[model samples]
Target: MIKITGEHHFAIDRTLFVFALDSEAGKVFNEKNKLVTGIGKVNAAMELTQEIQRNRPELIVNLGSAGSRSFGKGEVVCCTKFIQRDMDVRGLGFEKYETPLSGIPPVLEYGLLKEGLPQGICGTGDSFEMNHAETDYNIVDMEAYPLALIAMKKNIPFLCLKYISDDAGSEAAEDWAVQVHLASEAFNKILF
Candidate 1:
């Protein structure tokens, strides 16, 4: 067993695993792993940064459930790109997802390729998505953008795998609750 001594006291190795908001999404890994959960973008960024600083993990893998209109429920997809859908600065002449003062681009891209996982673009916001026609992204989540951004800034390898739990429709929450367990199981299989 790997011994981890830090502020978090995690037993995980050099790789830090992360989840978001819901507990069901992390059910499998939470038993033996010290996984971080960010309820939203701000919380995610802060929590992930603190974990990275404390543990100095070489890589960070964020696994969670997501809503998608294109992907079928229970399908897991690796997010190659992340965008903040709630960061709207159109009045200041910046694009919808662009952060004005930040040097980072509106869309942060992860080039890592994982075998057997389909590639997708994840658009993240604070609110749960109920309409699929509002955005063009392949998946919708609440925390992936900040997690990806923090990982990029800290120069750590970041990989995001999201399980489709809903269709971003009126029944998304209900669907998500039912599919989260399956997502967690799928994530565990991929990681271990």
Candidate 2:
């Protein structure tokens, strides 16, 4: 029993999962409940708010691709924090990522997931690039951040399951898509 809407609408079954995006892709994972929109983070929050204003779920699981600085091929990571790495305020001699608002709970320090979980920093940016490397970062993406911010704002449980699609190197651009697919499969194993 898989329920899907847009990339966001999901239902709980034996294994609840969601693969949301600003655009439509693949076969209808679940057609009756799917939603399609280009509106992001803020708009997604509003949509989710209105939806939940009607019915709230227990948890939200986000699955997506991300660039990696330290993670190896086909690695899965549970984010402790989401960073907006592109928010550069260097022009003003300051540094910040312009986080939306915080309300989400902190990651469980020691839980069932900690036995062999990969620990790393997940950062967000509009573009996927290897040249823009940060020594402290391990992963990069465009969506998880706003999801984290919105989840924080709504005080909801959020888990980001990401697959490492690229390395912080020149070849990453051409290799990302294939790597993303490989990583997604690996992520499912770790998560399930």
lDDT of all predictions: 0.78, 0.54
lDDT of 2 by residue, 1-192 (tens): 222222433244322234445222233235333333233344444555565455554555556666676777667776757666766555664445542333222221111122366766677666657685575467776666666665556666666667666775787877675665465446435443
Per-candidate alpha-carbon RMSD to the true structure: 5.3, 6.6
Where model 2 places Cα greater than 4 Å from the true spot, the runs are 1-11, 14-16, 20-54, 90-94, 98-115
Lowest-lDDT window of 10 residues in candidate 1? 1-10
> Could you tell me every candidate's TM-score relative to the true structure?
0.88, 0.67
Least accurate 10 contiguous residues by lDDT in model 2: 105-114
What local lDDT does model 1 show for residue 30? 56
Going through the candidates in order, what is the number of backbone clashes in each?
0, 8
Candidate 1 has an lDDT of 0.78
**How much is the lDDT of residue 39 in candidate 1?**
73
